[model samples]
Target: MTRHQTSNNRAVLRTAAVPARKTLGGGGAAFLAALLLLSCSNPSGPKRNEAKIQGVVYRNDTRTPVPGATIVLERPVSVATAGEGGSYSMAFTADTTYITNVIATMPGFRSDTEQVVVVPQKTSTVDLYLRADTSSPVTPSQSGDAANIYLVDFTPEFISVSGTGANDVAKLTFQVRDAHGTPVDSAHGVTVAFSITNGPSRGEYIFPSSAPTDPRTGKVTVSLNAGTKSGVVQILATAQVGTKMIGSEPVRMTIFGGLPDQAHFSIAPQMYNFPGLDWLNRTDQIMVLVGDKYSNPVQPRTAVYFETAGGVVDASGYTDAAGLAGVTLRSGNPIGNDPVYGPGFAYLKARTVGENGATVKDSILILFSGFPTEMTLSPSSFNLPVGDQAGEVFTYRIADRFGHPMAEGAAVNVTSDGAPVVLSGDVNLEFPDTQSSSWTTFHFKVNRKESDPGAKSGNVAINIKVTGQNGNRSISLTGYVAY
Candidate 1:
């Protein structure tokens, strides 16, 4: 029997239509209202000073701790970082009343906030459950026992309609289900049809649009050609189930045309040093934002072209749903007079053709600040007699991120431990000191006569450290001397 017939027979056999439905719906509404009100209301009696706050943050669906979430407390504001187990704690002083407000936040997850009353010498715990952001255009799930079909999702929600036919296709995916709200695997081999419900007549679902659902998944895929015109296209899906046909409610997608209204551009870690010895592992990211005149993010997967000078970049790509596109740029070798140990610049440009065939463009100047990243000893190992003055133990070198020697005169401090080896020269020596002309080296000697012979037979550790003028980075080198 059809679903409607089954419902009718049940209704007539029992009293389920008027009184039962109305009574249950009314009770449910009232209960939900009360619950919501109670949750939003604050407690009235609160006067305690020695209270403690602690809680764990969990993913709403998985019930697992959300490590790295940040929790903040108001009123003499304080913050704490959640531990690996997603637990955090904060203490409030005794003798002061506090209606503490607690908030927890993490990127890509909805933040949770709550207010609790603190009583003297008591512990108030508040556990937070965070929901993942589901702000995408497509969401799929069954509601009730209904024989309905719908577009679960259509990838690339927006399309840039160029005059060419090859660039106008969008993939449309949908599902078929039975009246019981379960995917109808039996519906496999059943043909599903696609059509553009709202768009210029030029738009069409490509041939073979009437394809059978997959035998295992009850899903179907088809291609729709967005017409040359720019506007919103509503794609609809339908399939026949049993003797009756079910139609999927239509979903809307967009096609862009005309001059783009806006463009945004930025570079990640705008300041970085060129990776001299390690180019493959270091890179900067460039992000571009393209939008229509209305400032709405452009269509997903809209191709954008990138051009850069003074760097290497993976520049060709498309913008995502948020109208954002990203490319990685690795700093090229420092050129000309730009110091490899100082600041340098690279230029990047992003451009995309709007529907009107006009170029929408933006550019950014990526600044790279170079700093010393490595310290090395010409002779890494050293050995000394227990009672002798050693000369020029080893030449220490300082290099920037690009492996280029820093300017001469960089000052460094040396220290020794375990076996007090007396530094024979100045404690602070200029890099590549007067003894050598190299811009990055320093030579120093050690007098080990004062080293206590009983201490591991006068084994000593010599340490050399240097800090740049800007304090952006500090580099240190350690060498061990053994008798």
Candidate 2:
């Protein structure tokens, strides 16, 4: 039984090799043997050798052709792509390491790559698997975002990359395309942006070296440095007919690192707390920590300031020379009793001087993670008309942070030291309109505690105490009421 299984497996393997069949001729045997060795051998092994790779490009799954698909071949060392018909073949220099890129990508479908494949044959047939675009009436941005990238001309439809030297200048050529990828007479204006990473500045944006215009053929040059760090960096080009950005594309490149080193600032502790790690009250110490890359204390002249949207806390502090300085923010109002933590974040900016008095900017943001404690006091004054009996009405309202009638709420704690005053039962609160976020108002009839309407008017203080998500607040009103 074992021998039978082995024999069946051998038969299946040979059948799968049908596509690997060699063409007839005198060197057929030797050629087939060599081809197998090339495809099967690993370039990293001791038996490494240069090999030529070539393949026809086709739309994935379907037999449709992708004409002029730029085939770029690149590695740690050599670099190349493809041209027309979605095909690319290049030689990987013997000194090169890793797989050289043999990529085929169209506008609508995903890209496919054939990397360093050791092969003995003069040519290789590696079919790509590209997904098709099954969408309708979508813009290019949307089309590419979804799995559906539109199929584009293998060679750029309108322009080609022109110029030379990724270090000083490189040219890009293209025919103009409208919002739709259709070739237009020209783009009104074109600009390309460049930046160098791991150099003087990481992601330092610069304007285009050469401007482009509407023409059958357009060309724009890009300037780069020879010593830029060898890594993937972005190059963006924008073409504007007028004020609108018509079409933009990004190109990626890798260059050697050998320029001015760039550095950035940092936020200390990553979190700035007003009353950090402790209770927020008059008895606590409130301080802000300003940190940067050096982690050393900043000077008072650094010009640091803090601002919050809620305006509950006052940020007035300076970093000592050691980068560790603290300032205590004083809170005396109702905020101290029940504070509103945060419905937002706060901004902290630090400015200082570099060489030649040049200005340096460092900004940081801290999120409000904790709840606020809001405590309010209420009751603005209220009055009742003459002859207002137990059934009559007297109205009063609660106040907010500002001394104004905020809204309506039921119940009021009436108190007087001298007079044995009396009030009515069954008080009702009304909310015809709410002026403030939180307000309590009610109307009540005072009982005939002192039924001397003809007597002199009396004075009393009215107050309403309420509590909610924030904290406790009270409204108090002092005014004279006719008896």
Candidate 3:
């Protein structure tokens, strides 16, 4: 009996055990020679140049087998599952030394990877050890080597306030533990020292710069205050226990200077309509604030310049004591060259300088409230069967000048072009009547006309005319159908 197996794209024959024959005479010798020649001449004969890989998966903590672990071979991409004893094996062609990547993975444990080499006709043994992920909640040994140390609270991750006098503070907590994850208690105090690893300027620890861990508990708490300049603030802690030094995890904090790296703006009464006229006459109170890298308000009396894109505003102003600047934005006439309108956006920007001489700027967008400037047809193209009463449905999304969804109950009129397609009820266009925050959606269906004789595959166009309290706008799109 013969069994066939494939490895590395090559067919291999595994033959059953056979009995050996005793020494033969001249006839038997001649027969044996003929058989050897036949095998040698057969180009399709099975070759014996193959190798195997065997491995065991074990847990790093407990020198025990890790059954059900998955092991993968990189070259040729083969995988094997470990059996009861955590043993796995794979066979591959070894025409050349097989240098391959081997990886082992198990749930709740970190995967292990190794490089292996297999030679022809040989079984190479490779082993892997997977470690338990520390992030999971596992009990720590009562008494063992230190396993982990981490920070508890590094709050106020960022501070926009500059200067230590401003009380821009953050809290820091540290915990020490052993290999089994059990907190380590020190009979004598464990001296933990803190330092700033990186930042624009080294920040100061509020008090007790170097403190001893609680004897009963293995924890410590401290506070940090911002530095004079603007930049990232990083802190590191280390515990000195006897002759050994244990390091706590690092933490980062950001501080903003009085000089503005960024600014914020707000506008009141954002929407207005043009009634029987091209221009809308309105005024909006705009406020701007300058903040430093740490988010701290800039110094008082900073000058901010106001600019406009589609509107006009007070050109220049000074930031108040609160780092806020106020300006009156007005929309003049709705002229071709005017900067503001009902169906468009009016942009206002406030520019200032930081205490560090850095340029700071912020801008706000106001949508001239009125009719939508643009309309979109979802699935602009769709398929419909000719003569089918049920037509394809498309979603029409309406947006205002600032790309925001039109207010509820906005008015729109729909009409069609060409004979193949028409509005379902003479006028299919209308306001979505939706209260959606982003955009409104209305369903419209297009059907093939029954009276048209040349009903094959063709396209139909739909035109939309929207009338807002301010003005009117138009848009068009097409749909498709097959007979």
Error of 2 at 375 (Å): 11
Error of 2 at 192 (Å): 14
**Local accuracy of candidate 2 as per-residue lDDT tens digits, 1-483:** 011111112110111111221221345435434544665564554554565555555544333345544444333222234344445566543433233334454455555555433343223344443444563111211111011111122211111111111132233343343342333323223443333333323333334543543343233444443222233345455544445444444554432222111132333322232222122442223344433332322323234444333223445454453333343333222232213323233444444443244444454443322212333333244454446554234555444333323222223354432223465542333332232333433455444346554455666565445432223455555555565
Better of 2 and 3 by lDDT: 3
Residues 202-276 of candidate 1 have per-residue lDDT tens digits of 544555658887654457887776655566777777776568677887777766642344443332333333332
> For each candidate, what TM-score against the reference?
0.31, 0.23, 0.31
- Poorest stretch of ten by lDDT in candidate 2: 140-149
Highest lDDT model number: 3
Off by over 4 Å in 2: 1-54, 57-463, 468-470, 473-483
lDDT for model 2, please.
0.37
Could you tell me the lDDT of residue 298 within candidate 3?
56
Residue pairs in collision within model 1:
48-120, 49-94, 49-95, 257-355, 258-356, 432-441
- Candidate lDDT values, in order: 0.56, 0.37, 0.59
